[model samples]
Target chain A: MTATLSRIELMRGLVGMLRDEAVVAGIGNTNFDLYAAGHRSQNFYMLGSMGLAFPIALGVALAQPRRRVIGIEGDGSLLMNLGCLATIAMVAPANLTLVVMDNGVYEITGGQPTASAQRCDFVEVARATGIAHSAWAQDTSDFVRLVQAALERTGPSLIGARIERGPAIAQPPRDPAQIRDRFMQAMGSRKGFGA
Target chain B: MPSDSAWAGVVLAALRKHDVRLAVYVPDKVLIPLIDGVHADPFFTAFTATREEEGVGICAGAWMGGLRSILMMQTSGFGNVPNALASLAVAYQIPVVMLVSERGSLGEVNVGQVWSSRVVAPVCDALGIPHQTIERLEDLAFVVDRSIVQAHATQTPVVLVLSPLLTGGKVFAA
Candidate 1:
């Protein structure tokens, strides 16, 4: 697997294209990079649960059909719930986008090899799983163009960005309740918790 | 009194009363009517989850997006959900109402269903999720309605089991 993209650079590129799209980042290096790029109340860092970013985003997109939602997951986490890909394809929410940060390793827990370390190309897997619009980001500029197109489109899209693991800038706030509350408020789904 | 199968209708009525619209499920024989009902009803955004944890995540996200949601699965499937329930639903205080078609208990024929059935209650208790078993038709409406309504009010996940006594149980080979 040849890689040249940086995780943070890709994060900046992805986030830079968003206005109010809700981002659900999986519990991995993706979580840290999302917060590091720019913390938005709209960004819900799923900092503890692995493999849920896509499912959660699917739910959000289903509930709010007009609002776009994006989910970022690592190769390890996406591998954990590969079945979710089929589920997302079943509902096929037009407002959902998923970016699998395929570093081929669990870069968080000391860089252990993931099942996707070799012989697993998730873009092909996702395309086979019927995500309709799936592609690989050949470079950072291509990543931006793909994501920007995902935002403007009306189909569920999956972007597989092959990247090299680099220094994680920072971790999202470890407070789960605070993360949920802020994200929900930003979506206008709730008002002033506990009042 | 509602008959064994009519319990699905009873629960569906409660869902409508409470306005719970997002329905994610993987079904068994006992859940056929309810699952079918959800699919037929235009009010629900119903779909089959390929796996239980995926359903849990969807319900939580739907809740966050201001829709009441339910994840329906068999006891066997519940075995796949403790981590998701604990880490995402519980930790984030997202109320994901869970509907379980509990197998492997009284009148159960399959040996495989027993272990998962026996563990569901303990698992919910361990996760600090409120769980209730509906054994009779009389208890059906109240439990289903209150569980859904109160889960949202408290922002907690819940497990509602459909007992064989109420559904007549899935029998072996006709």
Candidate 2:
């Protein structure tokens, strides 16, 4: 399969397809590219955390079952917490869509080779972990198609996209409180408002 | 059902009163009764997480989506969540209420539990998380209630350390 896709353009496509939805991006390029695409109140940008976007998305999916929640994670970070896939599969929150960007290297940490470089298949991992709606995107178009399907279907889908590794195009705002407040307000989950 | 002291029940009651709908946990011998209670309740979502950090991440996510969540784990599990706490919970300023069962104190026999138990409090402190160790049954409600409120109000995580003295620590048998 042709997996050579641009992470930034892929993020823009995902962002374009979103409306009244919540997205949580992992630390480094996954978040940075999302920020560079365009910042949204529904977008939660992780500043330093790795391997948590999926869990956070699972939580969001559980909290707001009606809202479509998307989690963006990178290959290196995902490997750091592979067991979370099992957790996600166990809970199986149908509103969640996990998008794993596989570039086979730790792009943010000076481009160290990750386990994905050794032929680790994240889609297979997700499938084995009991996420039935898991697949690999052959190209950018396929990635968008899978994301669209995940958004439309009732499932906690895992979409693994192979991308070209490089430096992040931009940086998200470093203020954690601001990020939380904006996301909460946008999702209508702000405290005291009965969201 | 295992513990007749009603301390863990009191903690669960406080969680319910605070509108906590989700309880993400890694099972501990000391927390089994509480976990069982949460599972039996129809109003709550009790999840058995693969790892403690996964529970933290789930709790943080649940909070962002407008759900109040509590994470219950043993002291050893606390050591596994520093990155999740620091990056996701603390960095996002997500208000999480953690119920950690104390170990390595009150005549604890296990050497494995000692190090994590000693450092759990300091770890919370270093992360700017407000924590209180409950050693008495009478202090349960007050600590649980206040910590939940304070955490939500500040949009930060809080810890309620359950002393083995209060929950009648896991009894080792020969």
In order of appearance, the predictions have TM-scores of 0.97, 0.96
Fraction of native contacts under 8 Å reproduced by each candidate: 0.82, 0.85
**For all the predictions, what are the DockQ values?**
0.85, 0.80
- Write candidate 2's Cα lDDT for B32-87 as tens digits: 88988999998899988888888888889898888999999999889988878888
Candidate 1 stretches greater than 4 Å from native: A193-195, B1-4
Query: Compared with the true structure, what per-residue lDDT tens digits does model 1 show for residues A13-34?
Result: 8888888989999996888899
Q: Which pairs in model 1 have colliding backbones?
A: none
- Backbone N/Cα/C clashes per model: 0, 0
Provide the lowest-lDDT 10-residue window in model 1 chain B.
B1-10
lDDT by residue for model 1 over B76-142, one digit each (tens)? Answer: 9999898898899999999989889979987787888888788898899898999999889989999
Q: What level of docking quality does candidate 1 show?
A: high
